[model samples]
Target: MAAKTKKAIVDVKKQFEKIAEQFQTFQILNEEGEVVNEAAMPDLTDDQLKELMRRMVYTRILDQRSISLNRQGRLGFYAPTAGQEASQIASHFALEKEDFVLPGYRDVPQLIWHGLPLYQAFLFSRGHFHGNQFPEDMNALSPQIIIGAQYVQTAGVALGIKKRGEKSVAITYTGDGGASQGDFYEGINFAGAFKAPAIFIVQNNRFAISTPVEKQSAARTIAQKAVAAGIPGIQVDGMDALAVYAAVREARERAVNGEGPTLIETLTFRYGPHTMAGDDPTRYRAKEEENEWEKKDPLVRFRKFLEAKGIWNEEEENKAIEQAKEDIKEAIKKADEYPKQKVTDLMNNMYETMPYNLQEQYEIYTEKESK
Candidate 1:
């Protein structure tokens, strides 16, 4: 029999608020673009800072262009990426050239950093199989569209790295809603148990499509989900690139040193609808909420920081923006040059030894192609 004396069962649900507060979204730069945490700031040269800002600008522009292309019917499907540039791009800067990255759909920017050319990403959204081919020797996988699947796959990749005695770590990303998935728990658990080198970043963008995160889980912070797995968990202000770079850089250090996986939760938001495939944020999000998050835009804050330091100005920024646009236009041209996908080739690519049913279908496709 259990003995209960002078004890009240803690209300775990209510306690979530406290837990969330304790983790406290880490930030170096405030919304006003001031360094609030001097100690937490990463050592960055002016050139390095400029480079970081440039990447952020590039990623933001890429997102805007892709969404426009989708809206204009030039692209088949696209996931909006307006508000989470700092979270993905900054963490990517923390990784070495050899690191393996398993990305979610929202992680295309990071994938570009990992060697998926800009045009390839566009081709991917347009449903071209050629987009699936990553650059040579880039230790990155295609984007995982099944919410939390990348977490478990990252665990496996991390284990593989460890088994090979490699110094590299595998990093993966997911959203707040993804943190509620079973695979998310399983992936972190396995990595923690085996001390596999993996970094899992949950970009808690406040909502999973139409549903808010509060309705997704009772947990206070997505980072704390790593607690039960016995790994370090942290929360960072996703809007602060410097802070994100610092957090992931340290986590990489720990992982390569035989330490287990670390879970980093980034508090972020998506300024646009979930996907351009036909969704409307106006249906659920209040205009006031949107305006509030807009104030925290990573690009705006970083540009402010650069201006204050005298390392960046509007002319320089405009040049970078213009170059990014031109580069994107070139990539799109290259993507268009790919021989339009042949249906018969598609069937042939689907099999090594084709089953009779599929082979029969392949024959039909071949017959159609010859017509």
Candidate 2:
């Protein structure tokens, strides 16, 4: 009887593996900008599609400007999301205003879509604490630069929402490399155990800075990691804005319905290096790989889709580009001229009353700086 039970378990595991392999990367748009999966396409109005396209274009322009700013020594460091716009924009768009967002370092597009002022982002890049402050009504957290740290906080937020019986969901963004962190598992496990309304979006951009995905984890897909935590997982083509929107919409629906958390693995790529000041990818990754990804560039493909729908043209494209450039320039100007942060503001906020030691230290630092 024991031998029969063990064999049954092995057979079931093999069957599950076979079934999983059949789930291909979910995609709605083809490389030629055609909607191959028409069933999965959302019913977006012409104006809505055009607006999304404009945001994507703006995101690309922002990335370029950020890199230039870094090179010119205006900004400290920036993570460029050159190739992953669709995944970030689409996922954020699927959320309601009440839903919460926990973003990773490279998710600037998400923050922008969530109504974070561009000037604040610029200020943050310049190392200002005020840039981290979200509007009182905005249900978004500040961008977490420490890789996968946001996952744990997002889970806690979800738990609080569930406890309060609120319909809000928490969406946590992470990269493929972040999936390898222990906190990722811990967060997901807790979310599952508590049935917290959290959705983990992993942007699998093939490479994590210098390391490839294969070296990062042995799992075939980051989505598979959801299985151990007893949650649903889906892999979608991150380049297909419609597909990402659909997947996230479904996950958000499930979360609100108290169906527990879901993990979404967005198969995307980053055209640039890990950060503005990083080495060229041509050294670690082949030029061919970069060229191939360029062929499936999310912005390029989405533009084609919009054109097919008769909502975009060269004139509008050029106009949008110019407008984005002007807007970014103005933001930079404003951020550059903003008043400098007071040194004491940092140590004074967290405590009701300043501890004696910290107060003494703050005074000493201020006195020396004054001299």
Candidate 3:
């Protein structure tokens, strides 16, 4: 008898690559500000479209002023938001007042729109206690600095919302690097298993500090990572505000409708270094590459789109820039009035009732402050 032909061996890596290819980056507007996907265009009113453009303009100015403050030693820690306005503000505009936001360090802009005081955000960068304090009515948490930890926390928050039968969703943001963390997988897995109303956003800005994302994962697309979690996943052009808003708005709708979680990957870029903490993008990123992304700037693209619709103009954009400048000036002044954070404040804030050991240390610091 002829030997049976061996079946073709499974090519796991190639199969995964094919799966990744299936997750196309969704786009409504192209790089030239032309509507490429007319069907995907959001049903936002003309006023809403103009407002989104205004906010994006404001955020660009905010990001510029923030970097200047960081260099002048007026701000403590800042992640430049220059190239991320569309990915940040537009997605934020899609949320309801009752939804919860668990943000990463780069997501202060979202928290601000979610009712966090601008002065408090300044204080947060300055390491002031009041900066971390959110108003009682605000449905948000202080931005998480421990990378992907917010993902796990968001899962818990969403689960709690589910248990309470509230029609609210919990959303979180983390960078491409954060997506590689063990907590990221655990959080998504837990949320998927429990059918929690959670939305996970991965801002794939191409780098995690100095490390390019390509070195972090073999997966071709970050959105495909959601497949393992058993949830819907999508990649959207982060440079298109309309696209981001539409995608997030739909995700929120599905979440509140009891459809469980969704993972969104925003294909974006950061114009400046990862942080104001001395790391420079110039070392690793090519100037040509930076210039290429500059041509697709979210602010520029959205501005053109709105201008074509006749709802936005350069004058209106300038007004938004001026308003952002004034607001930043006032916020920094307010932040200056906050008393400096103390070691004792850290100890006291850590627990509702201080542990005996911490209480002893708190007394020591208190005595020092008394002198």
Candidate 4:
């Protein structure tokens, strides 16, 4: 047997084992869409709540439409946003139009909220250069497919915002899986060090592409990871749109006020598999778990709240959904109207001055196409 170690006082902050269990998840709506505490809810007019719900419905429909498009061979590699409407869509409503956005792949919904056209989003998914073009007025970058890359890149954008003395912030998002990357910590730490005006959101969807949260992280809570960076960390109910919007709105205020970065960990669930064509969630999570989360559906709860206020009904919902679908259809048609992509576009845009080898490759491709 080894020598026994002496017992000593423990630092509360370092006790990752206890923190996850102790952190109270901030929530505004109950499972049935009733208010848990009316006083605690965010102040929103009845019209505002309806608009919010409309967007959530649009997001869900868009996800379904994108999947259908992919199956029809009209789109390419796509991430399903079915279960994350509240976290990604509602949080976006709190952002200033001028805020710089660097988003992860699943965050196309947010990019749309930031002024990216529906057709452009479709174009990007189809691997077109037009997809990368955002109207210059919209201060955002195209979605990053590389895991955890947006964290550091957004940090750089946030630094620029801070340096320019603008009253804006740079916001970015990642998933629980992305939280595992070293760039996650490095970016947050760098932002914290520089007091960069940034907001880093981690949508902790419980499964990192089939790996349960228990396996993805040993930390009690992902928000606690921010403790190391000397910034405020918050845990919000990602299933509650009101809660998400309130949390992000407050974080934006803090960032614009010259406060450093914030790391927000949303306790959410991704209802679908990792992607439309890849990763089967069935092997990792139980159907019972899915059923349980379905009860907490953000759309249902928010609709109930709106119904209570006499601002929404089933008929209105159907019309909004139909309108959203028609809008998507029109946008897809516009995207298809774009001329077919050329080999020249692929080789010319990669660099300001094409390297020697790339030039030769470009010439070879051009010659072959001509022949």
Candidate 5:
């Protein structure tokens, strides 16, 4: 007879600790603007490198102008994107036009680059219905506001793409806080089980509003959570555009090749409050922490790398900034020219044939407007 075996007690916490140690933080550039991992650098051409830097700079300027507009009551429901340029833009830079983008509320910059016009983005911020309208060729959904909802939706979109025999991927983003939601797990697990082509990115910017990442979960890293779903997970230096681009490009390739989904945790930081709706970062985060993250600013890091290559300079950056300002000015003017949104507008767009109850309400609202 075989020797009787005794059950072994498993140390769950220690196992997780060891598991976390296996996932390293991927980086191509250091905080000092030096290439630390030259081997992992993306194969971007000189022009492409400069273009990445240019988009990051333009996005920074856009963030600044958006904050000003929010303060002046010209914009609504604004989420500041000052410190997430590399994580947002560079990953998007890796995607092709055929890939579908499912964005969170903070991902408007990516949507804009993906073909949504600046005026439409402004309108969306102001809660106008027309903002939902997109160009016929654009393959993106509106920025999701209900936190982790986009994660589940992205899984569906990816499944749809696979069923159609399309060689494209679906990508979505959420914050560190969003990783805590049940939908996040459901989305990744479903995609992994079915081998759906999807990319899930968690922009771990240290906080979910006021709660820090420490309070969110016990897992050592968000990326490691992908293991349970049978997919690869990676943690990338979000401040390094090259690293983000490389990681995303690899993930996209794997996805289209039927390797399923990837979970990317970008180690980045936000330099402002969660939103313009009366939150304060000082109450929760320290000034020293903010300063430390500022040292790793994506724009500064990428600009340094490009300057070293003789591809970017102050003059080029200034031109980009000025162009951003002019474009924002024109978009805001267009938004101002739009007819004021009304209750009737919302009801009219609810469906092709309104129900009896809805039609009655619509007529009542229409009569009130006429008066």
Candidate 6:
């Protein structure tokens, strides 16, 4: 009787799995640039759709510009968000100005979407420390280049908000590669224990540098990791701008409502290498794979949706592109004109009272520069 019961349970599980296989990946727009799931559409107006499209296009253009600048030795290393614009912008649009944002290296679009001036990003690219200074009322931290480091900081900010009984939520962005770090689990656990109002946004771009997602985890979905933390997890099509916006909005709503934290896994892909100086992706991934993703490009998909709503046109596209180019150009000029950061500025921020060794070194460096 025990053997029969075990066999029956296994059979039931298999049946349910088969049913699950029929469900589609959460998407508002289909591959052919059509709205496949109207039910999942967010309450976005025509102007909002156009504005979002403009931002997406601007991000793509800026990414390309940054890569060119890096190649020309005008900027330091840069992480390109070429194909992940929709994922970042959509999630950023769902945020409130008072909420805090913790971003990884590839979140330029998110910062820009939240009114981070283009010049500031260029300044950061140019290696100026002050470029990291976000505007007042903008609760955003500087981009974290260290893998998984932002997770704990985000959790800490959220915990502070909870302590103050504030309605603010902290939005933290990380990559699939970052999930491997021990800090990821610790941060999630901390947020869960305290019921912190934090939204952990994981952009699962299928590859972490050269490593594929299959090699990174045995789990079927990154969202499943949230289950262990006792938090709600949801997977959404990261290429679908509206879908991402809706998911983040819902997560933010839950967080602000005292429902606790959420883990959002955005299924997306990166069109470029890990960074401007990184090796070619052709080594690990194939041209065909890149082509497949390009077919479902978020910008193109969203443009189609906008056209369907009668809000997109060639004139508007041209105007937006020209404006973006002018804005980016002006930013580049400003960054170029900004004074180079002095090396001594780094030592000053290291300690309240400079250690004797550091003080001596600072003097030596200053004397050498003066000479």
TM-score: which is higher, 1 or 4?
1
Estimate the TM-score for candidate 5. Answer: 0.96
**Global local distance difference test of model 5:** 0.94
TM-score of 1: 0.95
Model 5 lDDT-worst window of ten:
7-16
Deviation from native of the Cα of residue 162 in model 6, angstroms: 1.6
lDDT of 5 by residue, 306-361 (tens): 88888899999999999999999999999999998999888878778888878888
> What are the per-model C-alpha RMSD values against the true structure?
2.5, 3.1, 2.0, 2.4, 2.8, 2.9
lDDT of 6: 0.85
What 10-residue stretch in candidate 4 is worst by lDDT? 14-23
Clashes of each: 0, 0, 0, 0, 0, 0
Report model 6's TM-score to 2 decimal places: 0.92
Q: After superposition, how far is residue 96 of candidate 5 from its true place, in Å?
A: 0.4
Give lDDT: candidate 6, residue 275: 84
lDDT scores for all predictions? 0.89, 0.88, 0.92, 0.88, 0.94, 0.85
TM-score of each: 0.95, 0.93, 0.95, 0.94, 0.96, 0.92
Residues 253-356, model 6: lDDT tens digits: 98889988998889899998888876788999989999999987998888888888788988988887788788888988888888777767777756788898
Across 1-371, the per-residue lDDT of candidate 1 in tens digits comes to 88767655797666776667668788999998999999988987899899889998988888888887887787777888888988999999999999999999888898887888888888888878888988888999988999999999999999999999999999999999899899999999999999999999999899888889888887767888877899999999999999999999999999999997999999999998898877998998999999999999999999899899999999889988998999989998887887778887676677788888787888888888888
Task: For candidate 4, give the lDDT of residue 232.
Answer: 89
Best by TM-score: 5
Stretches of candidate 6 off by over 4 Å are: 1-24
Candidate that scores best on lDDT: 5
Better of 4 and 6 by TM-score: 4
Model 3 scores what on Cα lDDT?
0.92
Point out the higher-scoring one by lDDT: 5 or 6.
5
